[model samples]
Target: MRISMWVVATFLLAAVSLEAQARALTQNQQSVCRWGSDIAAGAQASKLSGVSLYGARKKLQVRKFPRPWMRMTALGITEQTYNSASRLKPAAVKQTYYEQCVRHELARR
Candidate 1:
């Protein structure tokens, strides 16, 4: 059970790595970007503990996040960002996402 959970977590991280950069995303998109990157970081941390991201893709499991639907949207964003910049490392990708997310959040304040 624990192993599966870890696998799911790692898979989630794997999917979440790589965010959009170079081009700007709308505020709404940035919101999702932040969330997905955050989730990816958590997932990466979980992997360091030997967790895998194999089983966490299901909606029921995704409810661990505040908004399950949003998480699904995050997956889409993560995938798109990752594909757009496959050459970049995950850490760099997360940093870019973080910067954009922070900027978007700060503007609202």
Candidate 2:
């Protein structure tokens, strides 16, 4: 019974970790979509983490507008951005581009 409990706890921890990672990735995706080159450039120049920037944006969003539906809008924007940019290559490539772009932007700052 102890072993079973341990296994269950381990599984729960893994699930939670995966969920948090997914949330972070989704937030980054939304930020990339909404601000695109601008945010990426800023992040790169400022030497800031993309996830941190996204968190700041989220805080600003809640302070200015308390609508929960904004999350849906972010999702929609990410989808559109992905669809439009993925025409020439895979989505992963575009994601990498944005990540690198952020780094470049941060470097400048």
Each model's TM-score, in the order given? 0.41, 0.26
How far residue 80's Cα lies from its native spot in candidate 1, in Å, is 1.8
Residue 33 lDDT, candidate 2, scale 0-100: 41
Residue-by-residue lDDT tens digits, candidate 2, 24-105: 5546554644355333333333222323435544543554334465545544444344334233333444455555544544
Could you say which candidate leads in lDDT?
1
Candidate 2 at 109: error in angstroms?
A: 19
Lowest lDDT 10-residue stretch of candidate 2: 39-48
Error of 2 at 42 (Å): 40
Native-to-model Cα distance after best TM-score fit, residue 48 in candidate 2, in Å: 47
Identify the runs in model 2 with alpha carbons over 4 angstroms from their true place: 27-109
Superposed on all Cα atoms, the candidates' RMSDs to the truth, in angstroms, are 14.5, 15.4
